[model samples]
Target: MKGTVLVTGASGFVGRFLCMRLISESWNVRGTLLESESPSCLADKVEPVTVEPLGRNTPWTHALTGVDTIIHLAARVHIMDDHAADPMTEFRTVNVDGTAQLA
Candidate 1:
């Protein structure tokens, strides 16, 4: 094991695939999901961790502990509808703010 690799949004499509590939390579994997989501599906494949948004009072210190590398795949997807809420804000919140905190 090359230390623990932290993967945010490990329950998602791309995240799942990345995790599986890492597992096959014999790397120690740690996955982070929102507290509301279930990570049991990856139980045998990798270690699952529940993390909340940065401003939601979620403790990130524990999640980052011993993490040699971090692959952040979590983000708020863009809506096709023009009437949807501002995409810039959503992108900033997840892509910018979230990524900054993790880094």
Candidate 2:
């Protein structure tokens, strides 16, 4: 069997398709969801992993354990109406910091 693969933001469109394709290829698939209520497009096809938002001191060791590859798809693209004033800060935290945390 191939090594495990961790797909961040697995609920998203691209991630969802990637998970399915990876499963078809016989790779061990693990998915992480950002929103608890997000649709499970690849339900039962991949192991679902829990991961918190990437912030200061965010811990990701548990998420990556036993996983050989990480396909980072999580990102903060839009600032919510009630979100922080700086869009860049929000993006950096989720997009940049999330990648760093995974490393």
TM-score winner among the candidates?
2
- Work out how many backbone clashes candidate 2 has: 0
Worst 10 residues of 1 by lDDT: 50-59
Candidate 2 C-alpha lDDT tens digits along 1-103: 5889999877777888888888888889989865454545555678887777776567778778899998988777654574678777877887777677676
| lDDT of the candidates, in the order given | 0.78, 0.77
Clashing pairs in 1: none
> In each prediction, how many residue pairs overlap at the backbone (N, C-alpha, C within less than 3 A)?
0, 0
Model 2 TM-score, all chains together: 0.83
Query: How far does residue 73 in candidate 1 sit from its true spot (Å)?
Result: 1.1
On the 0 to 100 scale, the lDDT of residue 28 in model 2 is: 94
30: Cα error in model 2, Å:
0.5
CA lDDT of 35 in candidate 1? 71
Taking all chains together, each candidate's TM-score versus the true structure is 0.81, 0.83
In candidate 2, list every pair of residues with a backbone clash: none
